[model samples]
Target: MTWKVLLPVGEATEVMDTLYPIFRLPEDGFEVVVAGPEPRLYHGVMHEIPPNENIPWDITREQPAYHVRATEAFRDIRPEEYAGLFLSGGRAPEYLRYDQDLLDITRHFFEAGKPVASVCHGVEIAAAAGCIQGRTMTTVAKCALDVTQFGGIYVDQPVVTDGNLVSARTWHDNTPFLKEFVRLLKASVAPK
Candidate 1:
């Protein structure tokens, strides 16, 4: 049987963070359904520290990237119907945390112990959902407070796995975190 994964996205969602799993999960037979505040096309952005030393910046630079189409709306999502959740990162989370519907959906995955993958600013959603408490995870250093502020432990690493939740600091750490997430998802469905 094919398992479905819910991915919440919004305007300015990071393209790299969102694309990797969307394409990779299908290789493992997981169908990814992008969920938005409303069902529609959302703009994505590229977040990175420019390679040129001419511009010294402390944080990532965001450039408009490809668009992501969210076929499902958060209000229309039934968390119980999906086997896992994948939270992508970007500036969107800075605002999306206020979404009540998305928060409710995020809480269900953690409460149910379903596999979840969060990267970069994605931590904001999980944090706002009240699901980060007591769990250790990683996200962009700037977002460490999202974990700690919500009563969770913050760690800096390529990947951090706490129970069914797997997280990474950024898309740069995607390989390790996604590997762990895929493993968790597969294990969750393994015959008991």
Candidate 2:
């Protein structure tokens, strides 16, 4: 059977955080379905602290990057049809968390015990959905508050795996994050 993974995204999504999985998932034989607030093209952004400058920047600087097309809207997502969920990092989650449909979809993945992976600000969406309560995870240091505020345990590490959920601090942690997430996905479909 072909397994499908749901990837929710929006404008300003971190390019590496969003695009790496888009291309990597297929290599493991999972069909990636990109969803957004609307079924349209959304702009992606790159976030990084510039090296050696007159004055150091405290946080990542966002710059417009690539364009990714969302084939489905958040309201149209059928969580039951997906084998897992992947939430990408970016400023987009700051607002995407406000969407009721997206929140509901996020809850479904947790409720069903499906494999779930989140990175950076992506934790905001899961936090908003109330799925992270009592769970331990990691995200961009700046977003650690989002987890603690929502009743989840925040860890300052590259990656954290709790049950079916796998989380990472940022795009830089994608290597370990995706490794564990893919392991969870493959295990979920293993013959009982």
Report the C-alpha lDDT of model 2 over 118-179, residue by residue, as the tens digit.
Answer: 99999999999999999999999999899999999999999999998999999999888899
Q: Which stretches of model 1 miss by more than 4 angstroms?
A: none
lDDT by candidate, in order shown: 0.93, 0.95
Once model 1 is optimally superposed onto the true structure by TM-score, how far is the C-alpha of residue 143 displaced, in angstroms?
Answer: 0.5
Q: State residue 44's C-alpha deviation in candidate 1, in Å.
A: 0.3
Instruction: Mark the 10 consecutive residues where model 1 has the least summed lDDT.
Output: 48-57
* TM-score for candidate 2: 0.98
What's the CA error at residue 8 for candidate 1, in Å?
A: 0.4
* Model 1 vs. true fold: TM: 0.98
Candidate 2 lDDT for residue 123? 96
